[model samples]
Target: MRRPSLNDLAAFAAVANHRSFRRAADVMGVSRSALSHAIIGLEGKLGVRLFNRTTRSLSLTQAGATLLARLDPVLQDLDRALDTLSEERGTPSGTLRINANKSGARILLANVVPRFLDLYPDVELDLVSEGRLVDIVEQGFDAGVRLLEAVPQDMVAVKFGGDVRFLAVAAPSYLEGIVPPTTPDDLQAYRCIRQRLPSGKRYRWEFAKRGAEIAVDVPGNLTLDDNDLLVQAAADGRGIAYVPEPFAEPLLKTGQLVTILDDWCPPMPGLALYFPRSRHVASPLRAFIDLLKRWDGAR
Candidate 1:
């Protein structure tokens, strides 16, 4: 077996990533025809089709996905190493990618990121909102938000946002004539609006009563992925919503909603900023970590 050159790998990665020969060539500062020829030459050498190209769109073949899955990390490490070398001369200025849930990002905006951007205006934040667990390192994210329990054992988890608790609430009008459940068991009788997870599963409402924590896959009339929509549905008397306390607390206080199942919810882990501790931190990640730490202290 022969080893591929840097040019071959770079060409392959760029083409696979952009999924467009023209875009890859533009980014690589080469003519489209030249880039195509290089890719053709590399493919002949490797003897595998890396891409499934059509007149309008390009898609990665199975072989291409496999190679890309392996190479993306290697390229990121190289980029990070290059950045570290550059850091010897001055402050870091580059993109820092993160994947977080919607509520987590709201907390960051409310309490963390403003100060971070104020401290370093040149640094860029490419934040993605996603609820499902993602392979941050493989997905090219520098870091991600996760619950303390959800965070991997090896990653360093910094508490950026304080603990989260679930709230079960319903509108005062909705509760009219209907006696609010005095106990967790009574919740089984009520219609609920629930969060539907990415896996097409309705989120079970979790509660704590006395010393026991119970997870109930309660029945719901309306199920959706959007947390805000769930809240709206609850407000419209569609059903009770089991949502993060941060969102429902304000409404509960205002009497727009009444809280139930308080004893069932123990404070769960807060929004955690975590990344692999073993890998060398890029300057952007280091600065972001510092920002989170500082923000945590102030909170």
Candidate 2:
């Protein structure tokens, strides 16, 4: 049997980790056709099939899974060794992938991302913004940004920004004839612009004040997934929207939206950058975290 090169094994691992030729190729900065051919060549050399391909889905065969289980750690160790060399030279150079929700992404881009990029021009930052929470290790992300409360307990979290508050707001026009909600339960009589979570369930509006807590499965005819959209819908007089304070600040300042049940909403823990406790932190990620801490401190 012919021996496969390091690149071949690395390519196989990339494909196996992502389970998508396109995504793997994108991460490796190679064309899909080239990546596919490399995997084919790798399978031929190894005399075993690595992936079970279909028109709609791609999954690893048992043999492929076995190879990946062993190869992933070796590749990770190799990467750590290479990173160590770069660290010795006092320069961090590599891709740092972060999975973040939209709010967290915006905050980072506005505050931390610029300085981090400027300081380490050799490092590439791949920041993906989405609503869903993903496994950073499984998805090949260097780290993940999410609310501190939502971060997995097993991961090490770096809290930043500050406390965040969710506000229940509505357009003055919508509230003209209706009495504003004095408490969480009063929302039942009003139209709410309900938020649909990434998990495909309606988000229950949570409120707390003076040792009392409530979760309201807000009633509404319209449901939206994105925060910006929900704010817009509320501003357009559709219904009340519960959104992050930042999202509604502009409209609140302009008097387009008025806060209701203000006493019930209090500040909660803010965004955090989290990573797996077990994996070796790469130099680039370590550098990024250092910058994040400094930026948060200076703010």
Candidate 3:
């Protein structure tokens, strides 16, 4: 028997969490064989088989599951402690991981990220753009960016972007044979492009006017999970799309798309940055939030 190294434990945790040697290896930036060897060595030291493997799938053994349940939190705590120490040493430094949807990422790319990096060279930014609403604390993210309504009520929220409006738009070719929609209900008669959310439900187009809000589940032949793809479909004459103004701007300018039911659409709370209120904020993360507030004020 021998002492298990921290590297071996980390490798084991990654593999256990992902249940795929290939995926874990990719995350660790190491070869599959190297990760396998590390895990094998770790198992030998512990004198227990950590995983059951078949060609199609991998599952953790009881010992492995117990180890993972305990190890993950310890590693997370260790990482947080180290980050805290880094903050105390003069300037803010260490990785600041953010989880954001595509639109939120777009806002950060356009305004905050580049400038923040220049302002705090010691901070490392890890931005993950996805279509899911992640639990920032559970996922070990410094913060997450999401639409205002999507943010959890338990978290601290900050405005990150300007108020945004959804526009029902279509290419001229798609609208040629059809009467334009003058109201939200009129959308039901048109071939609308719809968005499929990460929660496995279709996103009903939302519109508001004069203290009234309307959600329309317009029928369409196409539905997609990606916002960019939905906008592209509209530009290509597939169908009319209900999308944020920013995504449809270029096409509007180029005359590839024309808006309908503009009077029905009103601005909603835009993208917001949020984090668990109970957690201690890292210096880099705090500084980033301050920067966002300053930018919000400036705009």
Candidate 4:
């Protein structure tokens, strides 16, 4: 067996990281045809199929997955080493990739993006909004933002946003002919707009009463992925929606929607920026963290 060149390995890793030849090529500053040929050449040498390419999607094979797992740490170390050298120049200059959910991304962008960019103009921020909990290290993301409850225990987490609460709300028209739900169990008789997570599971509505917490698997006629849409549907008299307070606040203020179970909704921990504990933090990430800390202190 022959070993692949470092360039070939890096090319393979980029393609695996993005799972799209076009995107990988863009990131590598190469043409799609050229990137494809490089992968083909690497596969010819290894004599293994690394990627399964279909018309609609590209996926990694078993060999590709194993190779990617091995390459992740090496690439991360290389990035950290390069970052260390860049630090000597007294400027953080590199692309920092971040994975976050829709709400988390919104919060981060609203609060820190402008200021962070102003503070460190040399740093590039690549933020991706994903609906599920992802393996940031394995996916080649420098860091991830998530609610404190969703952040993995293995990573170092820094609190950013403040406490958040859920709201059960509906349009006035939708509740005209119905009795409002007083408890979690009462939602069983109500038509709710359910939210589906990225993992394909319908989210259960949660509430707390007295000293006990309950999760209600409420039934619904309309199901969707986005929380904002769910809030809209409820405002349009479709049904009740369980959403974060911030997303539904506008509708509540406009008298389009009214809260039903505010007492049951308790404040929980808000957003946190998290990263792998095993890897050395890059200067770009450290600068962003410092900015976040300052913002938190001021707020």
Candidate 5:
């Protein structure tokens, strides 16, 4: 059998890891049709099918699974070997892919990203922001940014920023001539702009005061996804909205919104940069982490 090229093997790995031709193509900076043709060529060379395809789903065949299991470590070792050359040259040059939630992305953009880019001009940083939590390894991300508490047990987490607080806020007009909620249960008597999570479930409002904690399945006529939208709805007097304090800070300063039950909201663990514990950290990722720590310390 003719040997397949390393590029084809890497392409196969990307598709296997992401389980989507489109996502793999995006990561590889190639067109979907081109990636598909490459895979077809690779399969012809190996004389074995690698993937099971359907209109709605994609999965690996047994041969493909076995190939991936063996290929992952080899590719990782190759990456480390190549990274060594960059390290010897006293420069980190590579693409660094990070999957981050919207809030985490905003924080990094405001603090770490700009400096990191300036310091390592050769490093291509791919930062994808989304609301859904993804398996960083399976998604082919060098690292992930998420709330510290959400980091997987097997991953190493570098906590940064600071504690976060979720606040229940409402427009002053909405509170006019009406009694504001003093306790979690009082939300039952008011309209709330409910939050829909990425998983399609309503987010339960959480509160803490002293030693007591409560989670309220808030009632609402309007349910929306995304923190910004929730904050805007509250500012428009649609209803009370529970969101991260940062999201409502601007409106609160302008008197468009006011915090209610201030004592109930307490700070919790903030965002962290997390990576697989078993993988070797590449030079680019190492430099980025160092910069992240510096920025975090300065904050």
Candidate 6:
């Protein structure tokens, strides 16, 4: 029996993860032919076909799948241990990838991230803003920020901000001479600014008062996916916009926006930072979480 080369095993893992020689090559920073040759050489030595290659696609054999299942975590642990060592040196330095729901990111930008960056200039932060929720572990993100209600209880959760909710608002000109609706059901009579969800359909405007929740499928002349644009349109007298409380706050303060159906807009939940428990907490992530926890306490 002979010991297999670590390089060959790494190539096998790369090919298995990417499911393509070209993509594996791109990730590993090698030529496609070189990556294919490495796989072929390993297969020849082991007397097993690790992948079933077709003209247009690649699929792993049973042996390849089993091998990948074992190597994936081993490689992940190796990387995590290396990052942990770097963090222990009194400098929180590493790439910290974060997936943030729109409002969550907004709050962080205003309140938290600047101070973190100022303290740890060595750390690199990759921030992605998205409307839909993403699985951070599967997507290779270090952490994610979402509404507390949106987070799964299994993950380690850190509350970051105070409770924030949505508010239905309209322009002064739009409400002038028009009776505002007292009940959520009454919104059907007025012009509504409809918002579309990321899933390619209109979002139902949700309202709650006295322990009863109602989702209103109202009519509208304008429809959009972005809350910012919808709020602007509503402020310009197009119709009522169902906007998150923080976004409408400054405008409401300045009398640029007027609230409607306030009682129906009850506070749901604020933001929470979450991550997988299995992975090692990188130093940058630890510091960021500490900062967030302190920020929450201060608020």
lDDT of 2 by residue, 179-288 (tens): 78899998999999998899999999999999899999988999999999999999999999999999999999999999999999999999999999988999999999
* Pairs that collide, model 2: none
What's each prediction's clash count? 3, 0, 0, 0, 0, 0
| Of candidates 5 and 1, the better by lDDT | 5
Candidate 6 lDDT over residue span 1-299, tens digit each: 24568799898987886677876786567999999899999988878888999999899999888878988788778877877677677788868889998898998888889999998899988888999887676455789999898897678888778788899999999999989999988999999999988778899998888899999998888998888898889889999999898878888998989998899999887888899877678888998998888887887
lDDT of 4 by residue, 84-137 (tens): 899998889988899998888987789889999998899989999988888886
Ranking by lDDT: 5, 2, 4, 3, 6, 1
Evaluated at residue 186, the lDDT of candidate 6 is 94
TM-score of each predicted structure versus truth: 0.78, 0.92, 0.77, 0.82, 0.94, 0.85
Off by over 4 Å in 5: none
Model 6 has a clash total of 0
- For model 1, residues 1-299, the per-residue Cα lDDT tens digits are 35678888898898887777876786567999998888877777788988888898888889889999998789879987888775785776777888888888888777778887877677888888888987675465778887778787888788767778878888988889988887667878998786889877777777776667677777776788887887777877887888888777667777788877667667877778889886668888888888778768876
Residue 272 of model 2, lDDT score = 98
Question: Candidate 3: misplaced stretches above 4 Å?
Answer: 18-20, 52-59, 132-143, 152-157, 171-179, 196-202, 208-214, 220-239, 251-257, 275-284
Model 2 clash count equals 0
Which candidate would rank higher by lDDT, 2 or 3?
Answer: 2
Candidate 4 C-alpha error for residue 149, in Å: 1.8
Q: After superposition, how far is residue 8 of candidate 5 from its true place, in Å?
A: 1.7
